[model samples]
Target: MSEQAGSPLEDLTAGGPAIDAFELLANETRLAILVTLWESYRPFAEDTTLQFSELRERVGTADSGQFNYHLDRLTDHFVDATDDGYRLSDAGLTVVRSVIAGTGIEERTLEPTTVDMDCKLCGSPAEIAYEDGWVYVFCTECDGLWTDRSDDERGQLARFSLHPAALADRTPEEIYAAAWLTTYQKLHSMIEGVCPTCSGPIERSVVVCEDHEDDGICGNCGRNGRGAARLSCAVCKEWVQSTLGSIAKYHPAVVGFCYRHGLELQYGVESLAQIERRLDEATSKVDLVSETPPRVDVTTEMDGDEIRVRLAEDLTVLEVSERTA
Candidate 1:
């Protein structure tokens, strides 16, 4: 019925376009949970990995139950639980990186930025830039700004499916082949050397489930929230989720998969930096490879799953219906 003129939270949400992404961290507890990531980086830099138990310790709130509730909320926001501990989600990393740059909704809570580098998007070198809690990179060529609130690599992978380049110099059928192959690789990596439930030859792959509680049966699991944590294209780091994958797959690259009932693209990775490096190498020389029709089940690691057998498709697991020795 009524609104204020100078509400601080209002200014925060002034970024209506990015509202979905930041909504996760909007809560005070969730914001604190995200800050824990920065803590994880300093003490365990040598460990080179963030652990959930460590996060629990660093976040040491009064109520263990309440702390866990916040942790789960934050987990759903940007991290995932694995046997190894809670690892930062790609979105989680984007949030953390933004915090490091003194950007993002929570950046104001931290000290100002000191480190400097060329704008990742624009190429013009600069230092001390922050906005909307996102470390922004401006491109001299296009005046593009990839926010620290976002991850360029994460964005590109999301778009690569229909990305003209993803299907480049090839027929639509061939593009699907590359897309399928890419999907396979992603699933292979996440199955973790074998199925957690079964010792049989488990492979990572996409599946269709009409029984899902969310939007239109979804293309795959963990993809419904693409709108929340979208980042700039990994290679160009200019466009916002404009890779071929987003256009064709109708999903972010990190969350793509195959669904006869619907298409999927579950390409979400643990580390944006690692995925960025890999895709950069592939995209640079892919000018000619794009012309070739895609084959194999899962050669492109980032195409679908983590990194296991360099799988081409996890869907094959359904066909085999049994694990291998």
Candidate 2:
């Protein structure tokens, strides 16, 4: 956290100090200092620094010389030393928050349980499960959303990232909704040329299948759909890939169409199931309009009205046309 104002591109590409950040945090005492500083952090307070003696007492490290040595090791990079005392730097705060969020800690797993919603594809009952930091939803019958995404080869409907903290004070159905909403927000941000993780600019491109097939699982491309939008943030290296229909889910034309059809993309388990159903149905008609300039037209049909969203080379909404089927 230097006082210098650096652009995101400069921050990613510029060469800086040769210090190894991981090597600096390898000590137990150094990590304890960071956690203690985070414990005393107050956002709006005028003074939030912890004195040397107070921090040492809370960490329970008796040796004064050893404590000072560890504190000096963290200065400027992780912890900031001030005239009054010490406070956590921006990097230190990030580390502590990530640790508390259970990023590296394997907390628990949940077995697949039948959800209250049914599969949009086959109308069979859908199941939800949590394992290894991902929430999965799949149909028990015909290919839910895709066929080959799971190890057990269940009809995978959705798989999104979820931390262990989401399991607290919530049921399995609620957990699915939370994960779905989070992923929806991320996808919307990515489609708008922003990184959902770091708020940096993103680059987008479409991957079109040469020989497309769409009978549950595609035999030509191996994916369930004809094209996917891939996004990458150069600053943070955050990556996201989704079907063309998913990227266009929040378009005003599409939202209006769903509204007319009685599908509300709200924040709930049932609403998420509706959204998934819409995506599954929309993928069936995705056409690769052009390969040289990379254009994809996604079609959504319901109630005898058809709406097509055309995405240009950059994946931005190029046009919206409606017709009666």
Candidate 3:
């Protein structure tokens, strides 16, 4: 095991040469060696490189053989040797970046808290969890033995590497994105098709409005505004109550029975089923819901010069005719 420095010296620690950009940080001397190298390459602060003996003095360690061992470990992390002396490898540079991001971890590296966990997937114990020793802590069933990402992360885009789907390798970011998208879809479904006006679910009701009979109306809104006719949108396939404005802009398809009709396409009616978008997808597309306001036709007699109109629901203006008598 490597030694670790408590403060700024952690940058020197590294896992295996392959696992982390820096994991061999546990040793004070080793950390010093890396820090010395860091100072040598610094933009300010004396930009000076020193030999092993000079490093020896700077690190002030008694054991020569031990110091050499630490230097060798640091050397292993980098393949590039600068014109003056040892430098970092490109892969080593990547380590420095990981260190900055605090993403680098060693294989089977003990954290401050040692938690013995059961193999979530195969019900294996911690021994097997670390048997192969991975940078990522995943169980095959509970989590795959991944490097940094969890199993669920890889599941979305054919990158999930299960024991069977080892071919499905994915990046931690990809996995995380998939997990988030799935959660978002679920959340959207929960809220979709819900009546914004009444806080009622969207799909279950079927009452129509007379005003915008073309777009389907919300049951709560429709029943409240019972005189209005209602139907579904021809273009977007959403249910909306008929409104004077929506009626002017709406396009309606012959409501096909048994998932029979849809937008005009190659197979027209046959293709409509595919276009019907399963209930899940339809709901998923629902936007942020706010209750649809009941259309109120406020009629105040205008003195032929101006009519007082009530506006609600954002940028909407409706004009009611003044009594002509």
lDDT for each residue of candidate 1 in 82-173, tens digit (9 for 90 to 100): 66666666677767765554332332311222222333343453323223322222333332322222343221112222222342254333
Error of 2 at 39 (Å): 2.0
Question: Could you estimate the TM-score for every candidate?
Answer: 0.28, 0.82, 0.25
How many residue pairs clash in all the candidates, one count each? 51, 0, 47
> Residue 267's C-alpha lDDT in candidate 3?
24
By how many angstroms RMSD does model 3 differ from the true structure? 24.4
Of the two candidates 1 and 2, the one with more favorable TM-score, higher being better, is 2
Query: lDDT value for candidate 1?
Result: 0.38
The lDDT of each candidate is 0.38, 0.79, 0.36
Evaluation by TM-score, superior candidate among 2 and 3: 2
Model 3: per-residue Cα lDDT over 1-325, one tens digit each: 5546664345434334334533566667766666556546654444355666777787788899988787787775643445565654555454454453333233222221112333333454322121122222333332232223333332111121112111134333333233323332332332244332234444322222334322322223322223322333233343333222222111111111112322221122122133223211211111111236533332222122212333233313333222233
Q: What shift in Å separates residue 150 of candidate 1 from its native position after superposition?
A: 31
**Cα miss at 100, model 3 (Å)?**
4.5
Task: Compare the candidates by lDDT and give the number of the best one.
Answer: 2
Error of 1 at 51 (Å): 5.2
Q: Per-residue lDDT for 36-110 in model 2, tens only?
A: 999899998898899999999999999999999999989989999999999999988988877776654447677
